[model samples]
Target: MNGKIIGGFLVLSALVAGAAMYYLQVYAFYRPVEVSSPAAAIRLVSLGGVQEAMLTSDFEAIDADSSPLRFRGCFVTPMTLAMLSETFETYEDPTPLNAPPWFGCFDAERIGADLETGAALAFLSEKNIHPGVDRVVAVYPDGRAYAWHQLNESAEK
Candidate 1:
């Protein structure tokens, strides 16, 4: 009886551990992938006196067959993510379907590509489309540009 009970308990524990690991891996799939670039290595000084910096290149920009431009950046801070959510609410157009208010329409595939690549900075800065942040820049395979916000001389801590 003692041997049977111990065997059952061990099996139950293993099952539970396996389930937990599976859940964590699935949840982490949506999380941003780490990226690296010289342009991504800079500190942002906000008007609110907040010092923000990127620890890794968590953003990317990729081209999708459907959209003219796609924007994707990591949601590292709640504030930055909240700002993006707000942009979707106020800036997104209703009739065109997935069109950025200031920029033209893009397909979901392109958006997904942007998310995969990390081009959020460039999308906002181009054409002087300011979303009211510290800096907005876009990098291409060829070159990079500071489209909106200026950079400050602060190292990433």
Candidate 2:
């Protein structure tokens, strides 16, 4: 009778310990941190004469101007892609933040092309403009355009 009671108590304690370990691993260890920021927004002019806008950070607060369409997602322009790839590689982590499974394709050459194209697009978009081809244009935020051009020229290798 004594032996049977001791065996039952051991089994019960083992089950409780296993349950606690499972709970901790599932709920406490694998959660991702929430992101907050300067609030990135993207506005695009589609080829069909439609203007699309997207807001990141808090996607629920989307509003559309003119058309009844609104978007709530991050833009993956060339610059952003290059930055993300570089960040991931710099960290030397096999897995990167918000990276897709096939992110290995973003080598140095690909990142350079993406950054150049993205920078051009960003410059045009700042002035509510768009470029027909992938070319760089220097723009200043405070309506002084010459500074960026001068900087770019000086930085050229």
Candidate 3:
């Protein structure tokens, strides 16, 4: 009947729209960030308000131009937490943003929990890296580090 056909069409349309939305959000906009890109640099803010680059290796990153908060990075730093804490301004509150599962390196939940338990230390990578977003970098004792851009207090207000 006509009613049945119309209902089926509506259901089909919704399913198609859902699939497209998922694809765009999870895959379309993101691109592998190259080592040469500024986003891949692991720099922290020094106590004197200067941004200093740290010694980082095995860097892997992903970014999406669609939003400033979409930048995420994973790397290893030779600098110990003791030296880093002494050298840079520590971030009082650090919350990491989740990356797509395909990326596999940056796990926001694990990083956040580590920060809560003192298993990792978070540093202010760059304040106001975007208009109202701050770049935060959290490092574990084993030299594993992850970076992400998050909304600052100003932006949250």
Best by lDDT: 3
The lDDT ranking, best first, is 3, 1, 2
CA shift of 15, model 2, Å: 0.5
- List of clashing residue pairs for candidate 2: none
lDDT score, residue 44, model 1? 41
Q: What's model 2's lDDT at 99?
A: 17
Residue-level lDDT tens digits of model 2 in 68-99:
11111222233342332233211111111121
Output the TM-score of candidate 1: 0.22
Runs in model 1 lying further than 4 Å from the true structure? 28-157
> How high is each candidate's TM-score?
0.22, 0.29, 0.97
RMSD of each: 17.0, 17.1, 0.8
Name the candidate that leads on TM-score: 3
lDDT of each: 0.34, 0.28, 0.94
Candidate 3 lDDT score relative to the true structure: 0.94
Estimate, for each residue in 1-157, the C-alpha lDDT of model 1 and write its tens digit. Answer: 9999999999999999999887653332232213453334434433343434523232432222232222323223223433433332211111112322223222434543543565432322222122221334333332322222322223111
Evaluate residue 154 in candidate 3 and report its C-alpha lDDT on the 0 to 100 scale: 92
Error of 2 at 65 (Å): 42
> Once model 2 is optimally superposed onto the true structure by TM-score, how far is the C-alpha of residue 88 displaced, in angstroms?
9.1
